[model samples]
Target: ASFRGVLTNGGRGGGGGGGALLRRSSSIRELPRRFSRQLSRRRSSLAESLPDTPAGWAASTAVLSSFALGYELRLQRSLTAPPLVFSQSNPRNDALRETLSRRRPGGRKGILTRDIKPSLWVGTRGTLSSAAAYALPHFGRKRRGECELNARLNFREVMTMGRDGASVGIDWEVPPEKYDSSLCRRKTSEERQSEILEGPIRKPVVLILHGINNDASFGYVRSLMRACTDRGWIAAGYNFRGCGGVPLTTPRGYTGSYTGDIRDAVQQICDRTASPSVPVFLVGNSLGANLITKYLGEEGYSGTLPPNVAGGVSLGNPLHIHSGNMSFPWAQVLGLGVRKSLFLTRDKWSQMTCRNFRAAFLKALLVCQTIGSVDDTLAPYLIRNDPVYPFAVTVGYPDAGEQYWDDASSYKYVQHVSVPLLKVTAQDDFLVYGSSLRKMSHCLECPNVTVVKTRCGGHLGWQESPPEEQREGEGRGFGTSSWADAAAADFIEAIIESRRKSDKEEEAIKKAREEEVEAEVAAARRRRKEEEREGGGRGDDDDDDDAGNAHMERRSTSEREGYIAARVAAAAAARREADEIRSRL
Candidate 1:
């Protein structure tokens, strides 16, 4: 039957109503499929008009996003959050600003306040801005090799056994062919022997510590590692117990406050490097930042830390654990991740000697709904009951939860951090309280510590719009998709360069001193020769001349001995003073 006739006359009769209705329903169902097919054809045409290949599409999307992000950033009224007010003059802050400015591509004119220009959308000033940071990757596309979440580089693993037989793994980034070739140099026989006895000249080490429940595999961590290696540095990531796919060697797990393994790993690195000249910069992200700050403060206060630790950079550091208000949702999510880690390693827990403790801990973990609850369950067992370094856990609170948070926090010992420390925090970081940062920064008396507060940069999410050169991977130069990584590399470079320059100046001074000493010795010898020629005359017999020569020789020897002894003593004193100064720096 014709379609129009069927609709109008109901299949030409009153009894055909049910058949017509059935036909109508079937037609209605088919309409959606027909429409979908038409839409697909149109979509295909539109996609062809845009970019056909995946790479081409990605490139186009990136270009469009960059333009959009740039516009948003430019339209913003204020670029940064409110400046942190300090009670005392903070020269370190000024120095840090200058360092960041200088390291920028165009020097001071690149950006205002700092080089880390947070993205306009994700970096908005809000209470949940930090939470937005985790969602940033979905909005913008990271470059192929930069901040790749799934790409795992082949890193050489170094395992260090702690005092308690537990192990911490360090994944070292293998340098490119260029770095290896560049590192090669001719050495003197003595220098070669010294290197053989000690170790090869180590590149300045930049060791990264990941956040809670995170590892070397994290995109951010790997990106930073890549950034370091790009700068010709020895980059490494420190994995906590059972992290980075390493099996848990012991029943014990890691806590924020438990820095014993970190201490051991660093000590091992220092030992392996042999030369104290090889600088080691410890960079910590999130929980790792807190760990580093606490560790540095503790070591700096106690005077047990190594001097080769040149500096520290703490990103998204939770200065005071209790100060920040973590949303229940975030807390629960983090708790779940922790629980998952525990579940994956349930076999290891089963082997634990304390059966009752393991049973209760596992049970508590299964029900943990917040990070606070997780810490409360984990801290006492990991730290207070630690078999290796029980006495090391000193920071405490009356309540178990408070104690875990307080002990883990860097707030207590932050003032004692002696190394040149760059503490970067975002005002909008959800995990960290801005007030705590402000208060801590205000009270900070350590001239070596610098606190940088950005208006945006949610948590560790300092993702900025990549510059044209960087986006194209052309002359990008030692940077990752992350602004924090770039800033850190620049800071480290500035420090290393400054140190080298200072060393060069000192060397010049030493050379000048040596030259002056030689000149004085030469002048003295010349004067002695002149005096001997004048005093020994033509009127003297051979025997008299000989006796006179012998007397003058003895006098010359005595004078030379006096000069040598005085110079040696002076040189020794100078060396002692220099040693003291270097140690302090």
Candidate 2:
């Protein structure tokens, strides 16, 4: 019988007897058909409402799955407890209200502001389940599926020679069409040549560094590049040696602690832009973050930091590599799909092999179940055997203790970083332990470093909100904007703004000092002129006195001569004897 008929009979008089009759008429087989039809109609309506695209379908599936999970969890919770009674004055409700009302402490001053809260979808709950629900769908296959929806990006490959004489590939993303037409594009080869001869345009640049075995072409990295371009920044990504799908010129590959490639890359970028005055920022994900932080600390400590690098933003960077390696097994178990995706870079592994290297390569492929195992197995052959390994050892991991974790850790160098550093990580990041991250709390003592720890962005995944919850200005690009991307962009902008304000203040002070110095010089000139004039008048008076004295001396001399002649005549006889006696005396 139809549900309508059963409900109609159940509502009739005779109470229990009417309900029993209604139940007896309602057959399970009939119910299934009726429900199937109803579900089919609803599905058809949903299909029509959704966009006819893969992203839309994936999004719809994710939304439905999330709702279903939430419903199931709620059902389970309800089954284990008494039925909830809705009330205005429930103490539990009041406590929940209070908890929701309390605001989290925002980012401090400088590069980050705590005021920039995560979207409601992200910040609403801090549970691992909620985090997985949001992260898995958006960051999972959905991101890869939606790659075509992203804004058009122009990429040019530039070959930079690494410190070890290896040719490194840097996929430099040209500015978006809007900025390219206005600020970046050159009209002719002659113009480009002239600009190179003179200097490239002075535009703010953002350098994007991808995760281990990943290149600039990855969807997440592209999203970050898009974010930078959207803000009118010249963004580029440095593909570590063989990771760019290009064969390396040398036998060596990039390592976590080796910063030589990064230094060379930064120099090339600065030189290409011809704008050392323009601010440059580093944005790194996961292993990339480790490398960047290590570089920053080491260079900062050695006082070899490039003058153009203004600040850095690290997302899902495992500071403690040893701990990160230890968690790899767990991450593999929890995110097997993500782990499997890591092996897609067979090109990199293929480049690391030789006649003797095949054994190690096969070993890494077969025995390495986690990223850490791969690192351990491959490092001895691919990295340590390189000719530059000795030099790297001298500069990077000099001690036995440091080499235990492949010297990939960044904790020792954290304190030495002087520039503004924004380190963002999700609480439920499977690869990085909370304890390991907690050890980095000492970095907070350094005023330039800001750590934004969210409850949920998994690993390098900062997924966007579902369609219904998404708000305007909350996200940008192919799908919902990632909170990490937003935070990094905001921090970079803040650093740039701070630098601008600082530059303006310095200019103002310099101008004021110059004006003051000029005023002093002018006053000194005026005083010198007045003194010269007064000295001239005094000289004139002295000349007049000298003339008068000369005239008096002449008159006195004439009178003395006359008196002497008369006296000499009278005393001539007596003077003769006196003169002789005086002469003898």
Candidate 3:
């Protein structure tokens, strides 16, 4: 029956008896299928009229949403509204400068995370996706254009490990056997790198690092890239060895603890993408989190950061002390399974993988000297080789235990950090252990760290699709994190404001203290004169005593007030600038 016929009959028919009612119910059941088919046909016609492919339809929708949201946000950010404020004065965009800095910042350590991560667990299931303008994508669409893909790719080595010259590579996908000719440099290295940084195109780049067993073109990578792009960021992920279309440049694939490789990769990408002043944000998830945290901490101590790197975000990191330990065991078991599946035994896997990159990994493993307690049982792949097993056993660690608690620990780095940082994690992540994460996070001393911990949603799973019909245990929520809206973009912008305001507050407090000291001196002089006039000789001594005590208290109070006032002044400045910027816009 026609969809309209069911509709018309359902609306118009009169059921005189129970039999008639039953008939009506049967017809109602069939209406749904007919209605769906009719709706699909209508939608297809509408889609054709709109003039784009299915992918384009999604892209267009995302763009229009971004534009509309951006326009509204810009409107709200009017130049004459509250001035965007910051302590550091940027005359060009003073108003916007203020709007960015006022956000609170702090990060929970990756090590002490179990409890804190729960607050961020967005439920895993909802209308996985729908047709509404701001609707989430169902599983199907997220698989395709999340990441732009060409056949395959690889990169030149940036660093070597273990003095043995074993090459280590860490990326989201498998390294392609042959590096793409298009990606090769015919130009001088400097010119090529410069071109990548100052591109023929201007786009906000999100350099992504992957977790265990993942690659650049995986669904998660694509989703994040799409989400970032949807929110107006140019996102890309690189392949590690043996995971995506790429083959292992070295015989062995990557491990979770590979910090040097990831850092070098970031440095290279920064060379390619970040101009001296272009904002660069580092984003890492899960295993990538451990590597990134260590990288940031190390960079913090080194005191030399690439000026192009603006900030970073670490999500669902394996920060718990137990994480690395667990990973070794887990990978050993997996290696066992994979070896059996691939018909390679422990003895053979060593001789085979040890040839090239395995040494680099083992060298990198030396950096994790704390894991001395890990034991030979976890070294399934290396236990056989006297060469490999002995190295694992003899490796020196920064800490006494083997969990890598101190080397990659973000707690120590917080005090040294000045960069803006965003830390996202799930509390209920059974894998990472919430308690350890919380301990580490609570101890991180950086004022620029913002820890967002959810109560549900295991691991990288978070959804922000209108809340009600969102997915469970998915990162769909963080996907909408683009600068199209104030909140999405503010994390990066806020860090800039933080430094400026800190400087401003310190200045204001200095001024306030000076004024207070001057006032105290004047009052002291006035009281001395009054005492001489009133008490003669007796009033002089008593007055002197009173003056000294009062002066001390006043001076102390002024200093305190000065510090507080400086912060207040910075805040006021920020507000005025933001108001002005908003008003103008």
Candidate 4:
């Protein structure tokens, strides 16, 4: 029977209701297959309606091929994609698990492990999408929007001399209540040197190094300064030469390879407080972070770092400079979009007055078209055409060969860093490629380095979930309260605390060793005195001599056992301290 006829019969029948219902159900199930066949027939009819000309055939084939290619590409991507473990568990939890597992007894010593779990809101999935959302606010207007909280913080700007005689601006922001009188009272260079010789000051100072073309006025910089101030730290944002809206004194601006300027800036900051031993921690973002890492590695290996530098926190650092430069095409695509948006909104690019600077900018714009073109065109142009202040080739990039790339990369220097270094990076940073970052991750094998890799957070863009008590119509600020900012601060604090614990452990171990040595020396003197007394006897009885030897052997055995026990205890204590430090981080 026809499907519709069976259904009508099922509704009409009362006596054979069960039989009619079964037939109706079977007919309903077959309807989909029948409809599918009809759809196929319709598709065939539609295809037949098209012209039989070569152009029509070519257009149809092209359309199908494009769809097939897209489907294949999508399928390949899905197949190769790494599973998002964050869906089941937080990335922090995974880090914690890994850290704990790695911290077992007999593990490698001197390596500091840190875990940071950024609180992301639900539905914030996909690295690229999250990065785009985070970077959405900074596209237009070079000037960052000033939040009331940031504006309230009192900032004083001071000009310091760079290594090349260029003036560098340092924005000093100290919490009003915790202001140090010594910092306020400017002393002569001689007096400052004298004070440093005495000892480092007691206050904690956080020195911030901004990225290329950025200064203290940048929202992120201000946010970092404010966060430091809130934590009762002396926040000093060091603006690279010619970056703080001021032309360079020597026409030469900062470069990734040059670290002398950073060293000079750090020295100037330390001098301001007249404390060589003050607890100073460096915080650097992007290029600034890369420079800091390079400086730390170089100075650390040379043992020339100022006594006050405790450790550092580097955010969105491109440690592999050559690799990063090689990935310029990806950076240029995102960077150009942002630049274009800014250009359309406000003719910001047109405001350039300096000839050399304009030329550099134009070269950069020209090189943005491709990846290798940056190194071939812009790099060479910058090196050769610095008419005002010639590029100092000997400072950082001394060679034009392969050595130049090696020397410029910070990855090679990571092994030499002596102090704790916390490196924070994101998987989807537009300016930095994941592959380049992976190359740098190898450096994290060092004991003093701790790397925190988040699933999302575009270059220096780490936005967290809004707070529970957020006011109506008030959106989250882009900088001061970002996840990256909080993570940096936490890592710094953890490093400081770990250092203190380590110092205490060392002191205890030292004291134990000293006591053990004194005890051993006393025992040796006693043995010597007993030997002399025994030797003084004219006639030594054989039985007496044998007894004395036995006693001496027993004492020696006891002393050796005691020494081993003490050493074992010390090792256990060290292990415990290491575990505590890892947990805290």
Tens-place lDDT per residue, model 4, 130-249, is 343333332221123334332323444545553446677766664434225545754444443333333344567898987754566776676666666555576778887666654455
Clashing pairs in 2: 106-114, 107-114
Cα lDDT for residue 493, candidate 2: 72
Cα lDDT tens digits for candidate 2, 192-237: 3334234584668788888765677776676677667656677777
Q: Estimate each model's TM-score.
A: 0.67, 0.61, 0.45, 0.54
Q: lDDT value for candidate 2?
A: 0.59
What lDDT tens digits, residue by residue, belong to model 3 across residues 5-76?
555465455423544566779899999999999999999998777845789789889989988768645433
Report the lDDT tens digits of candidate 1 across residue range 1-585. Answer: 565566666656564786668788999999999999999999999977987699998999999999987877774436543334232345545554565554355433322244444445644444433443333222223334444322223444546565667777788764432313435763444443343234564778788998887887676677677777666677888898889888887776777777887887777778867578789899999889888887887677555678778888888887777523567677887788888888877887777687766865786577777777776666546643221213243323346677667566677677667777877776667677453564475326776776666666667776554544342331122232566676677778777866787689899998996676556655655555666679874333454445555656676799799999999997787567446634653
Q: Choose the strongest candidate by lDDT.
A: 1
Candidate 4 residue 563 C-alpha distance from true site, Å:
20
Each prediction's Cα lDDT score?
0.66, 0.59, 0.46, 0.57
Which pairs clash in the backbone of model 4?
110-447, 111-447, 200-277
Q: How accurate is candidate 1 locally (lDDT)?
A: 0.66
TM-score for model 3?
A: 0.45
Worst 10 residues of 4 by lDDT: 79-88
